[model samples]
Target: MTRRRGRHDGQSGASLHTVLTAVGANVLVAVAKGVAALVTGSAALWAETLHSIADTGNELLLFVGLRRSKKKEDLEHPFGYGQERYFWAFLAALGIFLIGGVLSIIEGVRSLLRPEPLSSPWVGIAVLVAAACFEGYSWGVARRQLRVRARELHRTLAEHLIRASDPTATTVYLEDSAALVGIALALAALVLHLLTGWAGWDGLASICIGLLLIAVAALLARRSKALLIDESAPQDVVRPIRDAIVRPDWVADVRALDVIFVGPAELLVIARVVPVPDAVEVPARDLVKRVDGLRQELLRAPAITEAAVTVEDVPR
Candidate 1:
């Protein structure tokens, strides 16, 4: 087995920074929104509070995932514990759906059934605006990172985000985006409640925020699940790897290749190759040296952390 270093091999610092930033922002926002919700009795503010709380908790989970994923390979897990990140991230998505989305919807329904007078509407308005600003800052950080990664991969933002293997990055970006949208919805609902004395509008806004969280949670969950199940690396990554492995003079032809993501930036590559007949006729010790050389060449690509190559006879 040949293993190479990857870009994300030691980049836990960046991922931890992003998660910590979000956790701090969401904790403050959640506290402020909770107090404002109590003062105003606004369903929208209550829903926003739940959203912030969910986000804070999710960030904590991501932090744990990042830490646990760094555990070294052991006898139990020969491939290492990298996939623990995806497992924890998947749990975080479930938490968002159950705690954030469900509770918001329930609160909205309750408010709609038994309308209550809202007091201190201005407090909710002020709190929501501040929360938007905070969430916006967090969103900006994630967006910057996303843009950098996308440029490196030569893919559009949407395309890169959809196929990204790092659950921490994707989760933070999606959570911050949802938080911003939820804040906007809360602001609009508060404004409408002030304009018209209808408590139903506030409740409706809460429902909208809940639905948005559900959609985001679903997407995150799907991505995490795919990662846990061992999805293949993107073509952009695989093609370069194949090209690199096939360039040597001793490699006559590459008959088959399979590349799968074993972790955020780790790939498990298995290939079958046909050697030049002259090269194959060499002594066994020389053949071993040539194959080792070929493996080393494949390892030069940063993303191909592990490679297995088999020499096969040319097909009739």
Candidate 2:
């Protein structure tokens, strides 16, 4: 149990570090892209700038969620601030959709309706390359942070990237991936504009990038929403937990169980364990010990954070 607690701390720390890196890099990238958009009037550059801004805000929210989640238990909330993590993560998703996706699409459509000749293609290209490098750095950190646990869950890189409940790392990876691809689209548009002397291609590219961002944001929103709505632990996890409580010698039967994720590494579990008919009330004390032992078994699954086992009807 102690070792499991240590691992939980490690997970939170890793999430913090990755999110901070992403936020810092995104600040620089947002400024650079914003300036490039102003100087060049490239629609794609404007789209990228907004993307960075949205990413920066999302990272802050994730960091808040990460930190607030660690708050100690209190009378008002005996279960602690675990749900704070999920709430903020949900906000982060909405931010992605509203600030990142919606704004980009609106700008893209406006640009397409009224084309503007980009003044400096080279400036846009250089900024895009720099943004890509910063995104790569952020992605590297997040990947390293989540890699070990991700493998233990038998998830591939893409699966972890998409399904990770930690918004900080997940947001950074998604934003960075979108930023890299947006750079490509921007460059393509710039080249096309230069080649054909047609300004509409730049706007068209912006629209495409915006559409792409919407798709990514939708995915993030869906996952976060699921977490917020009390999604259950995967069967791979629930089965073993059910098995653990039933294995205890004093337990006659187990009924109704509720498992919830309080934080990325924390779970708030409510289980009803029935005792054997002949088991004395005092022997039930040992069952609590055995149930505590189940913490180790639960930790093996990696997602059940804290389990609360309540013995349901002791034999009189």
Candidate 3:
């Protein structure tokens, strides 16, 4: 089997950095927003507080995934624990939907019904601005990692996020991005409420933040589900392995090739190939030896973590 080099290790390290940074930032921001929400009674601030809380929890889950997925292979799970990332990320997405989206919407509706007067709107705005800075810093870190991964894969930033196999870094990137946008929405609502003396504006912003969180949650859930179900790797990954297997002169045709992502940046390859007709001249023992050698050689190739070869005869 071809052992994965340090490429995946580098990815995991980068993801750990991104998640840890987010956790720290979110914890600080969540506490500040919680205080601002209570003091100012701005519905937008309340919604933002919920958003920050959800993000803090989600980042913690992401950290767990990053750590657990890196666990070495065991007897029960010879393929390793890579799917732990997907499982925890899926739960994190659910948390975003429930805690951030649903609760924010509920708070907005209640605020609209009661129409409470704002006290110290300026305080809320100050806290929001500070939160924005923290979220911005975290967003930049995730973006930097995404850019590097995209460059390595020869893909655009958008493409990488949509089709990433490893969701650890992507989860942080999305949550932080949503947090930044939510801050802007809350900021706008606060300004409008302050100017018009209408608390409805703040309530409306809260609803909008709820919707944004739901959308983000849906996206993350979809990506994680695909990976958990054994989604095939992209064409860019499959094409090269197929080429390598078909390159040898003795291989007349490849009958079948199954290539899949058993883990992040890890692949398991199984192929059935038919030898050229002239191979009949070789003794059975030598041919078996040759086939075994080919299997061993394929295992040494880069990015091929596991491989199986079967030499099939051409049908008469």
RMSD to truth, every model:
1.6, 3.5, 1.9
Residue pairs in clash, model 1: none
Give all candidates' CA lDDT scores: 0.86, 0.76, 0.87
lDDT of 1: 0.86
Tens-digit lDDT track of model 1 for 69-96: 8877667976677788899999999989
RMSD (CA, angstroms), candidate 2 = 3.5
User: What TM-score do all the candidates reach, one by one?
Assistant: 0.96, 0.85, 0.94
What lDDT tens digits, residue by residue, belong to model 3 across residues 47-140?
Answer: 9999999999988898888888878776797778888999999999999999999999998898889888888989999999999999999999
How high is the lDDT of residue 115 in model 1? 82
The Cα RMSD of model 3 versus the native structure comes to 1.9
Q: How does candidate 1 fare on TM-score?
A: 0.96
On lDDT, who's better, 2 or 3? 3
Tens-digit per-residue lDDT, 236-262, candidate 2? 446667887788677788878887765
lDDT of 3 at 115: 89
Model 2 TM-score relative to the real fold: 0.85
Model 3: what TM-score? 0.94
